[model samples]
Target: MVFQIAISFSQSIYFPPSNSSVWDTLSISRLGWCPDKVNDFYNYLDEQQTKSFILLKDGKIVLEKYFGSFTKDSLWIWYSAGKSLHSVLIGIAQEKGDLNINLKTSDYLGKGWTSLPPEKEDLITVRHQLTMTSGLNELAFFCVEPGCLIYKADAGTRWAYHNGPYDLLKDVLESASQQNINVFTTLQLKIKIGMSSGIWIQVPPNHYFLSTARDMARFGLLMQNKMVWNGNPVLRDTAYYNAMISSSQELNPSYGYLWWLNGKQSHIKPSGPSSVPGPISPHAPEDIFTAGGAMGQFVSVSRNTGLIMIRQGLSASDDLSGLDLHDLIWERIMDLGCITSNSASQKKESIHLYPNPSQRYISVDIPNTSPIEAKIYDLQGRLIQKSFDPKIDLKGFSKGIYIIAVTDKSNNLIKIQKIILQ
Candidate 1:
């Protein structure tokens, strides 16, 4: 069964009129952002070869700027960022009863779709492809042919960012829906949301999507609103939507259905060995998720701040999928809204985690507070346990990693730490 995450939030986001070509915009100052910081943000983005940048608040454009000869109408490739779009199409197919993500992919693609034997190939599922857990080998060049789809492990036992399996998702959608991808997207997504200027370009065995910056922002808004277009329910499959945004597996907590999630205790980079010991985007909001391409193409959303940040252009960051540049942009964006107080900044937390890779229990050197409480969360951001005592017990709990959050009487977050159990 799909875990149903409970989140309570109400935001009346502004939606552009369905028949109009114009968009409603918000001013930076009106949103409490200092006007002077705009230039500094621009300078950083410009030096990194940024072509276009757009920031939206509550579905309204707040900051939109184009660099060099690029304009609002310029078309830019989303590269691997288009993976998220394919995820959306897959969701649509599931909703229409055309396909089921839990079913074996060979059920739709037929046997011998992969280099593996028929029985081994049938073990792969649509959900595995969505979560990047097909366990396919990532060493070879990008080729979706059956000969190139070599098996590295059984599906879902491991998570690896292999493009070979992902690129075939388009073929799966075509076979299941019996309709061209462009026509399906136009009818199911574009017309409902009034989005224009997006098209898919196929290069040999790979597919790349291109669209204007505004169109990217529109796509962000659609997902930000839980896949609802204005008053219409575009993909009313809330279970799939939740699975798409929440952590898909324990191996990489920072990934969700082809999207890069921001807030998790630990993460594994694409094809990286072992697990990195902290949140992927440490400086950004814990709830933010992103869709990105090579260089710096991105579409990021943070429901906590009611923000949708987008960027496009070339860059030198070797960290493929544009994660490096996007994190830098978020750090600067966090500084835009307000000023900092030196007095409060000087006070650092006294808490510390001992025997970090502990096996049983742990303690902290925390300050006193009225009704102080400690909470534990899984990588999916779900609350697992809580305590009122100083010493927290971990007996009987599965061996892995978890996030500990301590709060005061007024519900103020005092400290957060990532702890491991071995």
Candidate 2:
């Protein structure tokens, strides 16, 4: 089936053909990105184990690259990122009057949904589940059975990323809507937003969704437009949409219903107890929010830039939340200087750094006649060392990944390369 989508900029809308192969493209040169630098960015993504990457500007395809054997039609799992899909469906159910966030989860799932007593169990509401504040003990966090849901604190008092409570939301949605999760999602979201290739798969503890890279981008565009698609309202309730992307609770200010929000003062991870300082992705724009998943799956929406970025593949790190990979992508994008007017000319000169994964020292080769400076920074953007010498010592450096940044006389970043110290 052919699905239509609308890309809006200011008051203008562009509708591309329904054919999947015919996406509108934006000029990389006009965007001030050097083609070679963009290739370097893709090379970095490939080295970091990305399978598919797509970037949309104003709902038009700006960059789309598939690595190795992965193609445009490849169906990949979204993992926990699918939670955002569920969150939206919940909003639709509320808009249809089939479910109410204010009502207790027990009202729909019955009183025995949790092991807590009548009074405590009744306190756990659908809203609490959506906010990751169900206050249920996370002993066997992956188990959604009643016996596994022991009480810890009262609902809305604490925030913990527990999957059991979140998984139960599907049950709540199913029971209240009197429709299967698949049916509800199809009728409410996929069909409306031109996510024609998406499908949900039942996995233990969570129901994961799989789709082509373009379909995921379609969902990102839907979010970028605030739940509207092709000038049609997919989600009519603006208040709920705002809440789903804003702070849903106090404990994790960087988290919404199931989305990972940027620009907050502090943020917490899935298994972390304390909130960390700074935005989830310091290199990304503050207004960006994302639906992230295990093994590097991401659907990022940035309203300020009118861009939607989607990535899916094996993770470069073991972190299930893909925080490192997410930050790395944004860091590379910033290094590309895509939005800068002189970015193309600035990237014209390429610097070669050698002996990567070095044991002791590395060398830099600059083609420019002018003197250049090199600075080494850790993954957290902390400067480790700065030097004018071609050969820099790494004998005392700890064993980890570090970025080598090269700047010219004007202090413009000409090249950035990642190296591992052994």
Candidate 3:
């Protein structure tokens, strides 16, 4: 019953804000949903043992709530999501001219490190360590043997989600930057991006991180803008940004350098030492990427839509409790202009376009035309052209893939089509 409702709710749901931050007493309503929608989502979280959720859109706080002891200043563990932080540090290290990603890990860690009888030390590269395909077995994390984590398959030959391989990534960054991970993150990223306040680390009894839901949102937004904060390019490498979002392994096409790509044709490997049995849809996009952690902690970003969303929860693997809450939260944010869907069904059926992939000349087709409006945008979501008419020539348009969307009288989703002008 829970699963059925979850599927249905995910299919169609929207949230509309009842109050405004522009004023006060801001209350958002979930369109096409009942007040119990939020309650139901919360109930589901309770069932799955979730903790907190923070949803943001357009760099504004839309939904911020917590459960149990959670609060506006509470910081939860990011778990494996920490790996992404490590990955970003690598990029920063490169920007600062520390170490190159193509270099061998042994170069910094020294020549004596090896688990492979005697001949595999030179096979591991920084790329292998970042992608978790360094040929190290899952057991390497636990093996106390001299070089258990350093032996076996050669770099790039095998793909495994082993901590032993990725754990070294932190070491590489520290070695390259000549500073600890925390200090580097603070000075290079956190402080630069104005996120130094939300940083923390666990030293046995204390939590590893201290951040509010909004802080996570900021982090997600930074990724959405390709590591640009406040109009400044903090990352400095669009190529690394592209690589960060691109698939890193054949085993899981959804897995990028250290981030998780949604909507990709990929599956999780079920080989060995994994919590999940098979690859599962994270209900995202091939262009969408995220930082996911144990339980339900998430920082999802969509470069296409320019969206940043954050969620924090505590649950077992593949659990749907906290996820339901997140779904409802998303629905509300969508209504508030935080998320967008570019589907034909969401638009009017009366709008049309001609010369789908024209070199220069094209026409805008509208039925009973209510002053059909249209705008063209590139894959990077940049607006290049705009027209309002029944037939407008595209002699001035550039040659590239573009999205031509026409809005109707209601200002809702209208006709949106892909135009390739060669």
Structural similarity to truth (TM-score) of each candidate: 0.79, 0.79, 0.66
Poorly placed runs, candidate 3 (over 4 Å): 1-35, 142-146, 196-210, 269-282, 318-422
Question: How far out, in Å, is residue 173 in model 2?
Answer: 1.0
Best-matching candidate per lDDT = 2
Ranking by lDDT: 2, 1, 3
Alpha-carbon local distance difference test for all models: 0.79, 0.80, 0.59
Q: What tens digits encode model 1's per-residue C-alpha lDDT throughout 246-296?
A: 999998988899999987778888757478877777656678889978897
For all the candidates, what are their Cα RMSDs to the real structure? Answer: 7.2, 8.6, 10.2
Candidate 2 lDDT by residue in tens digits, 1-422 = 00001112222334344444677887765455657779999998898788999988787787899999999999999988888888999999999999999999999998798889999999999999888899998778789988999999999988888889998899999999999988998899887866668888888767888999998998888888889888889998999999999999888999999999987878988867688877798666567889988888999988866768899999747665787688879867755533233762456345678798799888887665677778886644457799888888887897666777777677766666778776
Give the lowest summed-lDDT range of ten residues in model 2.
1-10
Candidate 2 clashing pairs? Answer: none
